[model samples]
Target: MRITPKVSKAKAEPPLILAIDIGTSVVRTMVFDRLGRAIEGLESRRSHKIETRAQGTSEANPDLLLRLVWDCIDQTVAEG
Candidate 1:
């Protein structure tokens, strides 16, 4: 987050950008500035497992994946 100085000592804040990454085994969320630079303190991550079968097939539960993504988003926003 970036703050600008003003005559009255009040700070002008910049617009925030949130980024979410859902990978094969992990979900991650982070906050970034307009320039796409990540903010240092706003981030969340969670790992999930996929169901694998003996036939070399693997699957993930859609509901569980969605919930994990939402949880990451919520946690990251709370930090900001």
Candidate 2:
């Protein structure tokens, strides 16, 4: 006779809220609960650089920044 172990499914979690932060050099996203706590294993971020010149001017690609934010948010949402 042979014996096998059984596997169990994970329990459902409570509802979560989405949070996004855009900064000068990076964008990030995370899921949080009502208590203002970030949920574990549900965060994403992307690094970016600001364009600068010798004249002390700086800027970044608006479209690229938007896409990075969107991608991180989408990934975090799918995690919860």
Candidate 3:
């Protein structure tokens, strides 16, 4: 004969407010509760492949960066 332990699911919490900061080097997303207390967060570094060659150079793949931002936000939301 074998005995098995029962598992219980945790109660879901209220939705949190999300904040994001995107820069040339990295992207970050944070989640806060109604009271402005941080609940969860995520960060992702920009791809090194995207770069500039000459002086006053600034290069970026808008589509790729946008996708990264979305991914970071999604991760933070899921954690919260």
Models 1 onward score TM values of 0.77, 0.76, 0.60
- What is candidate 1's lDDT per residue for 1-80, written digit by digit as tens? 57622221122135666778888899898776655556776789999989999999999988998999899999987866
Off by more than 4 A, model 1: 1-13
Give all candidates' CA lDDT scores.
0.75, 0.75, 0.58
Error of 1 at 79 (Å): 0.8
Give lDDT tens digits, candidate 2, residues 1-80. 54322221132244556788888988999776655556676789999999999999998999999999999988987875
Across residues 6-60, which tens digit of lDDT does each residue of candidate 3 receive?
A: 2211222345556777776776776555455554332233442458777868788
In TM-score terms, candidate 3 sits at 0.60
- Pairs in steric clash, model 1: none
Off by over 4 Å in 3: 1-15, 40-50
Q: Output the lDDT of residue 8, model 2.
A: 19
TM-score, structure 2 vs. true: 0.76
